[model samples]
Target: MAAYQDTFTSIPLSELATLAQSKKDEGARFINIHAATVADGFVLTYTFTSNETVTDNCQVHVTADDVVPAISPLFLAAFVFENEVHDLFGINIEGIAVDFKGDFYQISIETPMAVPTKPEHATAVNTKYGATVPVKQRKGEEQ
Candidate 1:
């Protein structure tokens, strides 16, 4: 087994772009980006490898209404993951080199991976992003 160290740093959305650029300049390769929908909102994780041995995770906590800055300006490959995250999690991502506008997968539901709620209360609970219709009902029933 290999010994590895992981560093996780929390950053504000405002400084995401700047810090990401700095990491690129330091010879870090963008590995992946992911998000998890929590009770309060979302926790975005940006993974990078400075080398084969060192990995860094830039974690950003955001509310349902927060808009995260895109890191494509520094790491172009990030756009792909960012688009997927946007579509699945519905976390707003601003300023990517290639923006998908939340249509990355063409699924019937928007933000399919978002935290789930009962279909009946989805309209009221998810007022910020519209209602969450059940997948089965999405085809023939009204939203």
Candidate 2:
């Protein structure tokens, strides 16, 4: 909580935790967890509406489609973040943590995350320039 309160850039949460511990060991009065929160499909933010000479608009946000994974030996808060990911994105972290059956996406045996995007030229209408692309690299890679 405290870290999120202070963090500007997104550090891997475990790294943040380690850094927090080092600061505490150096006799820090208190430690802050700079992790951030999100809501309404956007990562919660701390931002400046007006422009400044130098300060960037500070924000740390995570969306359901995006996730940062934990680092290891063991990060106590990592699982919690994983849970958050699952709660929001329907992912399973605990199972992955233990090398059990797990998938971030609800992948079925027949359709396991092989989704591909349509080619850019496939949908473009630049026939005046050319047929959007050379014929050699078209679908089926036909030359």
The prediction achieving the highest TM-score against the true structure is 1
Q: On a 0 to 100 scale, what is the lDDT of residue 87 in model 2? A: 42
Per-residue lDDT for 104-141 in model 1, tens only?
A: 78988777787465354354327667665563454565
Instruction: Assess the local accuracy of residue 77 in candidate 2 as a C-alpha lDDT between 0 and 100.
Output: 35
Q: Provide TM-scores for the models.
A: 0.79, 0.26
User: For model 1, what is the alpha-carbon lDDT of residue 137?
Assistant: 51
Error of 2 at 53 (Å): 32
Off by over 4 Å in 2: 1-40, 44-59, 72-74, 88-143
Model 1 regions more than 4 Å off: 117-127, 130-143
Q: What pairs collide in candidate 1?
A: none
The root-mean-square deviation over C-alpha atoms between each candidate and the true structure, in angstroms, is: 6.4, 14.3
Worst lDDT run of 10 residues, candidate 2, spans 109-118
Cα displacement (angstroms), candidate 2, residue 111, comes to: 22
How far does residue 94 in candidate 2 sit from its true spot (Å)? 10
